[model samples]
Target chain A: MSPLFTSAHEGTLAVSAGIGLLLLAASGWVSVLHRRKPGPGTRELVLRLRAWWVICALFLGAVLAGGRVGVLLFAFISYLAFKEYVSLIPFRRVDRRALFWAYLAIPVQYAFIWTGWYGMFTIFIPVYMFLIVPMRMVSLQETKGFLATVGMIHWGLMITVFCLGHAAWLFVQPLSGFPVAGAGGVVLFLVGLTEANDIAQFLWGKSLGRRKLLPGVSPGKTWAGLCGGVLTTAVLAGLLAPLLTPLPVRVAVPIGAGIGLFGFMGDVTLSALKRDLGVKDCGGILPGHGGILDRIDSLMFTAPLFLHFLRFYYA
Target chain B: MKALGQILRSLLFLAVAKPFVALVLGVDLRGRERLPKKGPALLVANHNSHLDTLVLMTLFSVRQLPGLRPVAAGDYFLRNRLLRWFSLRLVGVIPITRNHAVSGGHPLTPCLEALDRGEMLILFPEGSRGEPEARAPFKRGVAHLAKSRQEVRVVPVCLGGTGLALPRGEALFVPRVCRLVIGEAFTWTGDTTGFMSELEDRFAALEAEIAPPPFPSHPNMT
Candidate 1:
């Protein structure tokens, strides 16, 4: 499996180059329209966006460094994300033994992905781990609210482990035909483009955003932010296309926008769960930030969807 | 391993009790700094809502006050599996039989032992919770403990507005503002019987100091 860039696919390269510039222009436009005049918060958002841009570039550099290094980064992301998820929803003493099993799944899931054993990785949490976890809980014979207890554990694992496992799958894909260096680059591309949408929407919403989107579910979400984020994401995806897959410029733009839109839905869904639970900030470990669950809520929804798309288009 | 077990036990208690407590319950703690910073301290608090224990945990969760154990009788907390586990392991509860004969005489050994170990023990002293703002007859347990461990700092704490949250035999915990007043610690000095009487008197004074003025409609509005 050679790097996607090894193919020197000019079509993909042109798509990435074109989309990047357009996305920048769209983001600028959204900033101008919403803020009308930028305030301190708006200025901070811009700084955050710039920081993300540098991070993406650094990650891209690592992917270009080598395949093994790229895979390591994917594994690291899964580790951090899963750590954050577990910290938010800690287990009771009776259920804590199952925690070991849950932790054991992380390495196994990534290992399966490294070996390209897609079938095993997909079923690891929902199937095998599901059976084992409940049995472990029942063996104690505590027998109080058993169903609700087990269900929460299973659900938490599904989002944190199953969804996150997809990131590792990016490495096993054969990216020899792509314009970028490796399947790892495609993973980086998808993550960067998706996260960029989050930043864009947040920035736009804080500025010129007036109309609320799904006010009951997520009071802060706004239509203006959604429009701006989608535009920006699609354009960025198109520009970055040359560094990853051989998708046409037209395809990259729309696909990025679609991912961004869906990603927003994912964020809101997680937010709804927290709101229903009547919790503010999932665990409050991060000084300014909330919890691990809060940070990765978007990825929980987007990872599986993006992976399915990858398999559909390139498999 | 034993020390680690004690801490893990506390965390387990917090984890289980967390759900029972609604996030809506708000606390406006007054005189928190008055919490004794040193040894052999007795936190004598008025009981109103059952959730008072959790509120206390939240208050002291961040700070380290050695030998800080809440005395819970076997009748209420130990009757169930979950609460028993929580009370024994996490709360460091000391079971005291209510109005039962002490076969060996001197039932205050547990209290004295705790103080000797340089730990803080919380006592209800009224033996059970009372109506909000209404004072109950103080049990001789606090007086007995003070008489045995003369060095023990007797800190009286009054909790207000808890019964409104989960009054007797209620499952639903309604959110309400709860208040806590920590009275200054005082020493007990006198003959055996007189010392116990003095202890009761000091307790009454602390109660009066913390208890709010009776409403105009109060039947016994003295």
Candidate 2:
């Protein structure tokens, strides 16, 4: 295995590029099909495919950059997610003052990741911010809606900053037997499988699904979709884990199933949020994807869990 | 020389101040189509933060920035030399005395003159910053100006979230999303009392238009 590109890692990149090419071809085909028989859903599908190309390119670019750049890329994602979350929620006048502290927490949390201070990075938001955010609000002496306000801001920080920050921390993790060159591949494997599960579920549900999984929360998810997604993700994880990480194939299968299950939970959680907020999307920042929050809803669940799974087993 | 200064000021506003405020505050301008492309108009808004004026200034098109003059309080803006320079040269603020006894002149004189010159004048009819998420009653000055100059269009702009951004007494500006809801331009010839009530209603409606819905309850509770 060469230091720069092991045969296995090179194969992974080649497969990723192959997937990108296939998506491009599919987009071109859809463009032509839409020109002939245009419908709103078809038009949206074309847009989604085009957006996929851009997202893939960006993800691949950041993965290839490696080291601190990869960490900063994830940090940027967390910032956008936090912004989207803040914009959606109704904040009190006093809560607005506390939000300054909440927004400041993002960079400080990421700074922990960049510097590789695992102890502080793990506890900063859940422990320090948990105590300090309310203290800052208390000093203002506005107690109206105090508990709810603190809970909301703290929840936003946890999901958007702390949870997503774990993905960036993956780059710095010292997997006992894994080569450093394979770190990007490991990050890619988790991201790719998680996202692939989402797509597979949607496709399977549309084709063969019945009996809604959580009809009230998310009308689209179904039992058939969940089963298909979990099975497919487990198989994919088993295949890719050997190439990407030091985990044995048996360990990879359950991790894949865990990501699929948790990813669904995340999606449903956000769906419940949008349902309550009475908004279809968090914001219109991403065309066809709704918003940054909408796109990364599943990652909010998968990233942290995968990080811990790796940490407990490999670190 | 005066024209040159005006051009430089407009350039600075467009290049520096506009983007700075927009980026920092996340300013969103809605109902912009209601504003006239080129006409004499009076813009009355609710003031709660220092960002209100800057948000309003950045809303105009480059061609309209030179023609728009923000009516700032003379007591607050004219006391300091640097602020006076900023209000006059950079923002094209027309300082009006809130206390008639202090100036011994009509407070509406400069505003009327600017309107008569076919320039757009922006006014905060509340006169001063009030409690966050609340509005003080509109002063009769805006109604009187609207009544007197029936030819000039009166547009009510309701700014949401600026109060939270800088609020009344806070010196440090917090970056948050602020929205400007520009109401429809209408000619008002009604009595001052009736006009002020109507303007207040318009502000209330615009505020409701952009306000976020209440937070969602927990799933278990539901």
Candidate 3:
């Protein structure tokens, strides 16, 4: 149950130390490259790096703060993500009230996680909000794009609130028999690998990308990047799982591979959404990273997958 | 004491209102650096949502807010006793009666007096909230207001997505990115027709700099 600063369990602190060292190396590399000569993306790369520093530090602080704080953080993340979602898409003006109700579902979903009510947490948005969204839209009495509006509201909640809420709910799951990193360790593992996988894929594609993975969907994604990201993530999982979670190296490696695959699925799916909307980024919340949705798009898929993965096998 | 009271009231209004506006809509305000540093200026934007006034008000700081006045429809905002008090005291809105024929006084008097007092006036030149994210005909009021004060700096702001966020009739706010593109300030000429056409040109240019509204284009254009 050692998740740095929470209880000073050596494993979590060690992971934090590794992350700190990685940050140091990255900044140092960026500086050295700058010293060589000012380049095109160097400034943007530095901004992205600085943002990553803040995001990583805050994420570590929140998750380590405890289950309640983790739930609150994820809830806030869901809030921002959902806000960006509705902002990016267009809907009939009559559905504004119903959309507000959709936003309200975020806190309710997180409340279930805060109280450790998994049963309600799992079904609340998918089941309850599904019905409520349509009914509320019908009450607006606007038949024009009626079903479409309902579908947008429900789907927005599912992706932004429902899926991301799983990461928070994972924090509250009891770490009983294995004395694993408790829930905190699992969150760190899942998020850490997912983010690492994203970076690996991006860097790999940047350096050695040849064949476009999905030319129409995401031109930047390459098969080389995909294989490289999976391999890199698999290794990271094998190393991290032993320290953070109760999963053995043998099991964690394959899970890491799955994360890479599902993480890509989430990324490309949101990319498709952006394409449909004809937007480059959802919003400019983050400086170089685009929006909150742009950053957490992969986490949307990975969070739910990892949560159900644990529920199915371990928990 | 009155000056102090004004500041205190603004603080109270901001404490409650600012965060709620910020929470619902992420305003990507561009060219804010061009905001007039002092008063006797006009902030003219296209009218879209009720939230447009609130969103514009939040742009100015506490110090700048006191000298600022929103030119609103008296009939709309002053519909009730509570709204009258709040709009007068807290919002500092200069409610101009839409139909001067019925009201029997110069509709531009309040705006002209505000400018003469060296106060900044926030005017929606389209007169009222039109179709969401669509530009309506530029009402001659703002042009006439500017024509009264020759030295007034007319800053054109195009608010995209405000109509989508709250619009005219909606009570609940849908979280949307409100793009506020502020153009460089210009002075008004004496001729009302020429000034109105120029204002339209400025707004058109500012609108082009922002993201096109996701909704279909309205059949009517300014």
Q: Write the per-residue lDDT of candidate 1 for residues A117-198, one digit (tens) a residue.
A: 7789888888998898788777878566567557766776787778866765665566435534455557666776777788
Select the stronger candidate by TM-score from 2 and 3: 3
Which model is ahead, 1 or 3, in terms of TM-score? Answer: 3
Whichever of 2 and 3 has more lDDT, that candidate is: 3
TM-score list, all predictions: 0.51, 0.81, 0.88
**Model 3 lDDT tens row, A210-311:** 999999999999999999998999999998998788787888999999999989999999999888777888887777798899999999999888887777
Segments in model 1 whose C-alpha atoms lie over 4 Å from true places: A1-62, A283-287, B1-222
Q: Residues B1-222, candidate 3, lDDT per residue (tens digit)?
A: 667668766886578667766665678777879988889999998888988888888888777888989998999889999999778888899998988688777888988989999999999878889788888898888777777787889998888888977877667666777888889898877688888888888888888888654543211111
Docking class of 1: incorrect
Instruction: Score each candidate by Cα lDDT.
Output: 0.65, 0.81, 0.83
In angstroms, the error of model 2 at A28 is 5.4
Best by DockQ: 3
Best by lDDT: 3
Interface RMSD (Å), every candidate: 17.3, 4.8, 5.3
Per-residue lDDT of model 2, residues A3-84, tens digit only: 2222335745765777778887898899988999999988898878777887788777767655666787888788778877
Evaluate model 3 with DockQ and give the value: 0.31
Candidate 3 is scored at a TM of 0.88
lDDT of 2: 0.81
